[model samples]
Target: MADTFAAIATPLGEGGVGIVRVSGPGSLNIMKVVFKECPDKVEPRHVYYGHALDASGNVIDEMICIYMRAPHTFTGEDVVEFQAHGSNVSLRLIVMSAISAGARIADPGEFTKLAFLNGKLDLSQAEAVIDLIKARSEKPLSIASDQLNGSLGQEIVAIRNNIKDVLAQMAVNIDFPDEDIEQVSCDEFITELKRQNDRLQSLIKSSEFGKIAREGIKIALVGRTNVGKSSLLNGLLGENRAIVTDIPGTTRDTIEESSSIGGYPIVVVDTAGIRDTDDVIEQIGIERSKNEIEEADLVVMVADGSTELAAEDFEIAEHVANKKVMLVINKEDLGMTAAQSDIDKLKSIIGCDTGDIVYTSVKTVKGIGKVRDAIERNLARGFIKSDGGNIVTNERHKDALVRAKAALVHGIELLEMREPLEVAEIEVHDSFQILGEIIGETASEEILDTVFSKFCLGK
Candidate 1:
C-alpha cells in the first residue's frame, strides 16, 4: 500500500503563490513519474524546476519541487514540496494527480502526528507547534516558542527521571532486602517526597496566570448613566471604538476591544451605564451590563468627579465589592468640584479602602497608564516572580504536576507511618507515572491522539 499523502499547505485564497506538500515512502517515486525533470529520477533534498504533466503527457503547469529524505524530513519520512501556480483549482488538480500516482490525502495533523509517532517529537513539543501557530499575543508566542524548543519538555523529562530513579531504588530495596542496595529510609523518603511535591505544587500554581496570559483578562467598564464609560474605553484604546455622547443611555449595548497592557493582552468591555430605565432597549442594555460586571475579571467603576457620590454610586460599590475594582474618578478636566476630601468621603461611602481609587481626566489622557499597570498587576499575581521568569503554561503539565504532588504527599504520609518500603514504593511509583505522563514516557495512544488532534494539517 502507498504510504504517501499530499495537501495544499497554504490557505485557500488569492496569494502570491501556493504550495502542495507531500510526504511518505512513495514521495520521490511519484514526483519522478509526474514531474518532467532531472532525467526522470529525483534525488533527495534537491530542488528541481519542472513542468507538471498529466496522464496524457500534456503540460498542466510549471512548478518547483524539493525532495527531503527520511530521518531529516519533518515527518521522519520522505517528503516533497511542490510550488505551483497560485490557484485553488490548479492545486487541487496537482493533489489529485499525486493521488492517482499512489498518494493519499493526509488527515488533519497527520504529518505532525507521524512525526510524533516516529520519535521526532514528544507529545508536549508537538502540542507546542499548534500553540505557536495560534498565539495571538507576544507573551503567548514566547511561551509557546520556549515549549517548542523543549524547555518545558526537558523540565518534564527531568522531573520524571528523578521520580523513576527513586522508584527503581525502592524496587531494589524491596526485592533484595539483604543486599546493600542503598535502601531509602522512611524519613529520607518522606523528605525527598515533600521536596518534589513542593516543586510540583509551585508549577501547578502557575497555571492560572498562564491561562490569563494566554486568554486576555476581561475588564468591564461599569457605572451610573452619563459617567463617561465610553470615553475611558476610547481613551485606553486610543481610538473612538465606542460611541461617546452627552446624553445618558447613549450606549445601548456593550462594545468590546482588545489592547495590550504591561505586555499582557486585555479585552476591555464598554458596558452600558447601569440605571433605572423604562425604555425597552435601555432595559436590555442594563441587563447585559449587569451580566458583564458579574463576569468581569476587573471592574472599572467610572464615577462623575464633578458630583458627590449618590445612592447609585453606593449601589455600584456594593455590587463591585467582590471584584477587583479600580475606582476611576473621570472628568478631571471639568474643573474638579470634588476635591481630595470629597473623593475620600466617596471612598468611605463606597466601603473601599484608600488606594483603590484613581483620579483621571480621559479627555487629557491622564492616569490611563496607571490604570493599565494596575490591571496587569492583578492579572499577573501568582504566575511570575519579582525578577520576571518562566512559568508553567500547559494545562497537561499543570495537571500532571498536581497529580505528582498529591502522590508524593501520599508517599510522605506512608513514610511517616513507617510502613513497608513496598508501601512507599507504590506511592512513589504512582508519582513516577504521573511525571512520566507529562514527558510522554508513560502516555497512552489516546492521550497522544487527543494532543496531536489540536494541530492543523501539514504541520
Candidate 2:
C-alpha cells in the first residue's frame, strides 16, 4: 500500500482561494476523518460544503471540498482537494489536519511521481508537466502542452513500432532458416533502416530549437558609452529600462529584460560600454561586458554615425567579429556626418558584409522597426515557427535519440555487409530498448528520481 501524502497545491500567499491536495489509498479515509460535515458514506466526485476538523476534532477551516476516487485521479489513486481561503495559517492548518488523520507531508513532486508510477503519465509526459508550469511564453507553453499530450512520446513509439516490424522480419529468418519462408532481403533491410534513421535524425535536430524556445535567445548590446546604446535599448524595449545620460559608463553593470522577436522569446542584455577606463568599477563593468558578448547568441555593435570610427570602435568590432553580429549606426538624425568610408570600414572590420546595418535615431525612434527586422533576420533565421511540430525539448529525449540513431546506423551497416540476421537484430533491439527509456517503458529508478526531484510539491 502506498503511503498517503498531503500538500498545499497553490502558491503560499494571501489570495481568494488556496488548495490543499491529498493522494493515496488512504486519501478518502483521511477526508472522512477530517471533514466532519460529510456523511459516513460520502460519495466520490461530489462537492460538499463543510468545516474540516483535525484528529482531535478541532475546526481547521470552513471550505468547499471535492473527492475523486481511485484510478481516475491525478495520481490514479483516491484524491481530496479543499478550496479554502488563501491564508498561510489556514492552509497549513488544513494540511496539518490531514496529516493528523494519517497522511504525511508530501515531498517535492511526490504527487506527480505517484502519477508516473501509477501509469497515468509516461516519463516524458510527467516531465512535461513541470515544463508546462515553468513556461513563460506562448511557444514554450504550447510545446510543453503538446509533449504532455503525448506528441513526443507518440513519435518515439511509432519509431519503435517500425523497428519492431523490422525485428519481426529478422526473427522469421532466424527462427526457421529452412522453413520455406521469404527471407528479409538486405535491400529491404537497408531501405527501412534508412527511412527510420532519417526520422530519428530530424527529431534529434529539433533539440536546438527546443532549447531556444525554452531558454530564449540572449542578445547583447555592446558599444562605447554615449553612442546611444542605452537609448536604443530603451527604444526597443519601449520603455526606459536603462538610464540614458551623457556620463560615460552610466550602466555600470549589465541590464537585461525579456522581449520577443518574431514571436520567439529573447533576452536583450544592455551591457556597459566597451572602452578603456581607469575607474575600477567601470573596468569591472567593461570586463563583464566582454563576458556577455562571449555568451550572447547575437551581438549588436552600436556605433556613432556622426563621428569617425575610432581605435576603440575598431577594437570593439574585433571583439564581436566571430559572433553573429549586426551594426547599428546610431544618431542618423545627426545627418550621417560620419564619412561613408568610415562606416563601411567599421562593417568590414566587424565582418558584417551580409549582416544587418540599419541606421537609427533613438531620440525620435527612427528606424527602430528596421532594427527589429534586422534582429529577426539575423538571429531567428531558422527558428521554429510554432507550427505544432514535435520539438524535443528535453535533453534526455535527445540523448535517447542520439544513441538510438547510432544503433540503427550500426544495424544498417551490418545488414549491408550481409551479416547474419541474429547479429543485426541485437542492435535493432538495443535501439528499441533505448527508445523505451524515453517513454518510461524501460526507464530505471535513478532516472525517475532525478526527473521528479525537479518538480515542486503537489505538482
Candidate 3:
C-alpha cells in the first residue's frame, strides 16, 4: 500500500484559512485519530467542524475536516483536508500532528503523482494544473483550464487512435498470411497518411498563437530624448507607471509592466531615450536601450508629432531598421511642423514602411486606441485557430508530435515506393509508440518523475 502523506497545501502566509491535505491508504484512519468530530463517526465526503488533538488528547487547534473516500478523491484514494487557522504556528502544528498520526510529509507533487498513478488524470491534464497556477494572463488561464478539463488530452488520444487504426491494419496483414487478405494499397496508405500528417501540421501551426498567448509578446518603446516615450507607456498601461516629465533623460533605466490589449498580453518596456549624452550612466543606459530595441519582438519608435523629425530620431529609426517597428508620433495636441507628406519623407529617410506610422498625443490620450488596435492587428496576422480541438503547448508534446508525424510520413513513403511491408512496419510501429508516449501509454519512469516533480507539494 502507498504511504499516507500530508502537507500544507496553501502558500505560506497568514490568511483566513490554511489547508493541511492528507492522502493515501491511511488518510481516513489518521484523520479519525487526530480529528474529533461532532458526530463521532467519520462521514465521508462531508465537511464537519472539529478540533485537532495532539497525542495527549489536548486540543491543539480548532479546525474543519472533510473526508473523501477512496476512488472519489483527487488521488483516487482516501483524502482528508484540515481547514485550520492560517497562522504559521497553527498550520505547522496541524501538519506535524498528521505526521505523528502515521502520515509522512508529502514530496513536491506527491498528491498529484498519486492522482496520475491511480488513473485519476493523464500526464497532460496533470501538467495543465501547474500551467493554470503559473498562468500570467486571462487568456493563458482559459487555455490552461481547457487543457485541465481534458480538451488537449482528448485531442491527442484521438490522433493516437488514428495512428493505432493504421497500425492495426498493418498488423492484420502481417498476422494473417493464410487468410490471403490483400495488403494496404500504396495509394490508400499515402492518402490516409497525408490526412493524419495534415492534422499534425495544423496542430504544430496552432502553437504559433499558443506560444504568443503562453509567453507574452515583448514591446520595446524606443526614441530620442523628450519624445514622450514614457507618456506613451503610461498611456498604454492606463497608469503613471513610468515617470514623465518635460526634462530629457528622466528615464535612465528600463521600466516594464504587463498589460493586455485585444486579448493579448504584452510586456511594454520603456527604455532610456536614445541620444548622445555627457553623463556616463545615461550613455550606458542608451547603449542598453539600443540592445533592447534590437532584440524586442515589436518596437514602438516614439517621435514628437508637433516637432520636426531630428537627426537623433532618424538614427534611432535606422537602428531598428530590420525589426518589426511601429512609428509612433506623440504629442498630437501641438500638431506637427511636418505634414503627413513631410512624415512620408521622414519615413523614406528612416527606411520605415508608411503603414507602420501611428500618430498619437499622450497628454490628451488621443490616438492611443488606434495604436492599440494596430498592435492587435499586427500580432494576430498569423495566429492559429484551434477549431475547438487539440493544440500543443510545451516542448515535450511538440517533440512527440513531430516524431509521430515523421514515422507516419515515412511509413507512407515506404508504401509509395513499393518497399516491402517489413520496411514500412518499423516506421509505423515507431509512430504508434511515439503517440503512446504523449498520452502516457508508453511513457518512461524518468519522464513521469520529471513532469510530476514540477508540481507543488500536495498538488
- Least accurate 10 contiguous residues by lDDT in model 2: 379-388
* Model 1 misplacement above 4 A: 38-46, 50-62, 306-309, 346-357, 363-374, 377-390
Residue ranges of candidate 3 with Cα displaced over 4 Å: 346-356, 364-368, 382-389
lDDT (Cα, tens digit) per residue for candidate 1, span 1-459: 437998888788777678889999998877876687745555777778888876566677889989898889888999888888888877878887888888888888888888877888877788888878877777878788888888777877766667776777777777998986667765765666676677677677767767877777789998888888888898789999987889988999989899877666778999988878889998999888888988888888888888776678778777777777777888776767756775666566555545667777777655677666655665566233333434676788788888888888888788788888788788788888878777677898888878877766666
What is the per-residue lDDT of model 3 for residues 1-459, given as tens digits with 9 covering 90 to 100? Answer: 789999999988989989999998898788888887646577798889979877666787889999899998899999999998888788888888888889999999988878888898888888888878888877778888888898877887887787677777877777885687877655776777688788888877777667777777889999888888888888899999988889999999888899987666788989999888899999899888877877678888888878777878777777887887778888777867756765676577556566677777766655778788777776665353546666567668788888888888888889888898778989987887887776677999998988888888768
Score residue 131 of candidate 3 by CA lDDT. Answer: 79
Task: Give model 1's clash tally.
Answer: 0
TM-scores across all candidates?
Answer: 0.89, 0.92, 0.93
Task: Order candidates by TM-score, high to low.
Answer: 3, 2, 1
Query: RMSD to native for every prediction?
Result: 2.8, 2.4, 2.3
Counting clashing residue pairs in each candidate, in order, gives: 0, 0, 0
Question: How would you encode candidate 2's per-residue C-alpha lDDT over 1-459 as one tens digit per residue?
Answer: 789999999998999999999998898888888787878787889999988786678887788889999998889999999888889898988888899889999999999888888989888999999889988777788889999998988988898999999999988988988998989777897899899999898888899898888889898999988898888788778898999888877999989998877766889999999888789998998999989999998899898888876788888988899988899988888877778888888888877755588887767755777788888887556466444558988998899999999999999999889898788889989999999999999888998888888988878
Ranking by lDDT: 2, 3, 1
Native RMSD of candidate 2 (Å): 2.4
Q: Which residue pairs show backbone clashes in model 1?
A: none
The superposed Cα distance between candidate 3 and the true structure at residue 234, in angstroms, equals 2.6
Name the candidate that leads on TM-score: 3
CA lDDT of each prediction against the hidden true structure: 0.78, 0.87, 0.81
The local lDDT score (0 to 100) that residue 424 gets in candidate 1 is 76
